[model samples]
Target: MKHCLVVDDSRVIRKVACRILGDLRFETDEAEDGAAALEICRRQMPDLILLDWNLPTMNGIEFLRALRREHEGKSPVVVFCTTENDVAHITEALGAGASEYIMKPFDREIIESKLAEVGML
Candidate 1:
């Protein structure tokens, strides 16, 4: 099974993503912030990351940049899960090394479809 790291400050959101990923056959882990997520990346790199844009210590873009730089060309496929629907925000995430982007208020269908689009299913 594929491993997925879910990064979100909100516990509810993290749980939601984890459940969605679980339903899709992913072994999911949760991170409350970028710091924890980064540590987890260094320890065991997940196949995919579902990250939120708003975090306490480091935001999603910062986390993505850090992961991208540290892992070089072998980083996990990162998907930004954010409430920011602005195109510029999405572009920034992509530029920072996110593989895909999804807006917040997501249901299982959306998350499942997004993962499928990335071939995680």
Candidate 2:
């Protein structure tokens, strides 16, 4: 099974993501924020990542950049899950190396499609 690390500050979002990923046959792990996510990344390299932009510490961009720097393209592919709907935000996240980006209030279909695009589903 593919392993996914979901990094989000909201408990509800994290639970929702975990449930969805589990339902899809993906092993799931949780991180309350970017800082915690970084620690988890160092310990276990997941196959995919569901990242959030507005985190308590470090934020998604920093975490993504850090992953690129440290893991050097071997890091798990990341998808930014966020509320930022601005085009600039999307562009920035993509430039930072996110495999995909999902806006908040999304469901299984959206995530499934994105994952499929990256050949994770």
Candidate 3:
């Protein structure tokens, strides 16, 4: 089974994502902040990451930069799942190496489509 890391400050969101990914047959891991997510990444490289924008310690963009810089050829596919719905935010995330972006209040259909778009589903 593929591994997925769900990085969100909200416990509800993390649980929701974990459940959805689990249903999709992915082994899921949760992180409450970008720093914790990064530490997890260092220990175990997940196949995909569901990232949130506004985090406690390190924001998603900063984490993306660090992950890309450090992992390079081995970086996981990062999909920004956040409330930041502005075009600029989406552009910035994509430019920063995010594989995809999903607005908050997403459902399984949305996640499935995103995974399909990235060829993960």
Provide C-alpha RMSD values for all models, in order: 1.0, 0.9, 1.0
Tens digits of per-residue lDDT for model 2 on 10-115? 9999999999999999999999877888899899889999999998868989999988888876458899999998999999998988989899889999999999
- lDDT per residue as tens, model 3, 9-111: 9999999999999999999999988899999999999999999999998999999999999988535899999999999999999998999999988999999
Q: Each model's TM-score, in the order given?
A: 0.95, 0.96, 0.97
Error of 1 at 21 (Å): 0.8
What order do you get sorting by TM-score, best first? 3, 2, 1
Instruction: Flag the better candidate by lDDT, 1 or 3.
Output: 3
Off by over 4 Å in 1: none
> lDDT per prediction?
0.88, 0.90, 0.94
The collision pairs in model 3 are none
Q: Candidate 3: misplaced stretches above 4 Å? A: none
- The candidate that wins on TM-score is 3
Model 1 lDDT tens row, 63-83:
888888788773588899999
Model 2 sits at a Cα RMSD from the real structure of 0.9
Write down the TM-score for model 1.
0.95
Best by lDDT: 3
User: Poorest 10 consecutive residues of model 3 by lDDT?
Assistant: 68-77
